[model samples]
Target: MPREGLEVENLHLWRGEHHVLRGVGFALPRGGCLHVTGPNGAGKTSLLRAACGLLYPESGRLLWDGRDVHEDLPTFHSVLMYIGHEAPLKADLSARENLRYWIGTRRRIGRDTLGAALQRVGATAWSERPARTLSAGQRRRVALAALSLLLVPLWLLDEPTTNLDAEGQQLVGTLIEEHLARGGLVLAATHHELPLPRSRVQRLELTHE
Candidate 1:
């Protein structure tokens, strides 16, 4: 598979009456990572949402491989994965159950594959525990396990290191590094520094006006 590219052009966004993003633009090539940094209310989350078609920008375009993302919703979504601040998992479901539910049988991932993903995030020991019974950090780890099962080219992550301990944080960094090595792209909004190589990393700092 060829590495994908993402381009954001003149992006302008608003939150009700407030203008959050103004003319933000950047390009991420294959095997690249972009870290979005800023203080509170700087539209870092909004930019990620817009890039993945979650929120519509007032103006500008999001392009994937030189074509507008909106032009082909299915193709765009199939190639991208978005992980927001919330760990989108079912509290009543066990860690393994949650993965099975999210990935579904259509993808043909076996139990061993799911277990391996949990192990990668150090959640294998707690795979049978309900998400609600897990600590905040453990829940985050379960959510991150989806990254291993989904073989998408683009990743949009918001606050990926939230509630993680030192080892957990290091695990996330290592996973991201491996993803980049395989010709994947990542755009993350985070306050802490990640383990991305300097040569493959780009920075976008949002400012509130």
Candidate 2:
């Protein structure tokens, strides 16, 4: 059997009396993709946030690579990337500049590859345009381009397909497949279907009573 990717046990969260997740437990297998789905306020994003260490759980445990995440946040974080609902980009920077900044400072994937990543996301046309001047979809492409700079093993994405056209969606799908092929794990909260073949996907539905 393959190594366990991530694990959550009895995960419970609260926002001042509003219970988000309730006793959630699951294991993300290496090279697998888990799709988390739910109505708004069902805590899909909350769960992803907890797994990524952005939010602490009220009660429970989270482990990455079979080790407690909080025990070694540095190592755990090095192998994980989290993309939230809002696109994390700087308005003053051009698309290429943004990619180079992330690659050079955060990911260390080499600034020279920034151009290739932008081209792969079809944002090469405006790679030199400031992020604020680009359309929403165009901006999203630039943000997604940063993913190409990551060489980690786990990805946690929330609504990653938003603002993407059909072809752009297909592009991201292909990247997901490539990541899985390289033994990476994906835990994504998406409201849309992915355009990939032979994927191992687990759907999680959340409900509040």
Candidate 3:
């Protein structure tokens, strides 16, 4: 059997003169969840970005399934799905249109599948509204719908519950639980604690460096 998971080792990063991350490290296997916790300016987002190869760390190794991610980034990206703080929808595009355009490029998605995803996230009411016209919570729901449609094995989420209400936050927890049940991996940076079991959740707390 092979080592199946994502590993970040002795990671370090710098933004100008400030040392944002210092020796941050962790390893998460299939069905594993890593909660990256830290206050503002502690580099939680930077760690997630670096793990997904969006920002190269000054010094670190990111391994996916025992192989260096840098060896074949495209292959790694194919299995990874990243959802940042901001919903990546085009402002002028309708919510459905934005999802359609985004998902069409990555994989084949059917109308029924898309509708179900939107409905799952409680975004069906505004599914046809322009993204710019949607509220923050609505936009976040749209993003969650996109996440459902992507169906990748690994999720790198930054503040997934941003702008969501109590019910919306619970919905996110359900989505994560379902994803994890399917042997998916999740690395989330959030101020709000996820509603997951302690046995399945791993924590890495960073402080000002």
Candidate 4:
């Protein structure tokens, strides 16, 4: 039988002359969460990008259920979602329209579903406002709302709590817990500690080498 969940083995990445990841490896089963924490330039974001196939590594393999992800990139991507350091919303678009466009790329979503996702992340109040007019925290909320709309199994988030107050941060924790409860896997790279239960989170601290 195949091993369940995500596994990274002997990952090595280079950006020009600089080596970012140095043979990193880990295994995360269903309902698992991995928190990657480190200083800036520790390759935290790089690892997430690599895992989700946005950036390929010089040497390594990402396995889902004991099979190589590169074998079928499209199929692997269908089950993966990656949210980078910057929110991907369009500056000219309203929050609602942004979700519709973003979520529409992966799957079709209705207005009611978009509204519910925004409401879940506490961004429904300004869902009609232009993305440029929203505050950083509000934009982050919109990003989370987009995340909620996706039903993928693996989530790769970079600095998920970058611009949020205490309540908003807790909201992220709640959403993550709910996702994990549904047998989803989350790997988040953040500078500050996430407001999640320690028991459900497995931490990986990266360092400058």
Report clash pairs, candidate 4: none
Model 3: per-residue lDDT, tens digit, 83-128?
A: 9999899989999999999988999989999999888898888898
Which candidate comes out best when scored by TM-score?
Answer: 4
Model 1, position 5, has a per-residue lDDT of 98
Most accurate candidate by lDDT: 4
TM-score of each: 0.95, 0.94, 0.97, 0.98
Compute the lDDT of residue 115 as modeled in candidate 3: 92
In candidate 1, the residue pairs with backbone N, CA or C atoms under 3 Å apart (3 or more residues apart, or in different chains) clash, namely none
Could you tell which candidate, 2 or 4, scores higher by lDDT? 4
Cα lDDT of model 4 by residue, 15-111, tens digit: 9999999999999999999999999999999999999988899998899999999999999999998998789889899999988988898899987
Clashes of each: 0, 0, 0, 0
Q: How many backbone clashes does candidate 2 have?
A: 0
Candidate 2: list runs displaced more than 4 Å.
1-3, 109-111, 197-199
Which 10 residues in a row give candidate 2 its minimum summed lDDT? Answer: 191-200
- Model 2 lDDT at residue 120: 88
RMSD of each: 2.0, 1.8, 1.0, 0.8
Compose the digit string of candidate 1's lDDT tens values, residues 1-209: 43249999999998899899999999999888999999988998999999999898999989898889998987898898898898878999998999898877336788889888989899878899888899989988987898878988999999999999999888888889989899999999987887656766789888776
Which stretches of model 4 miss by more than 4 angstroms? none
lDDT of each: 0.88, 0.83, 0.91, 0.92
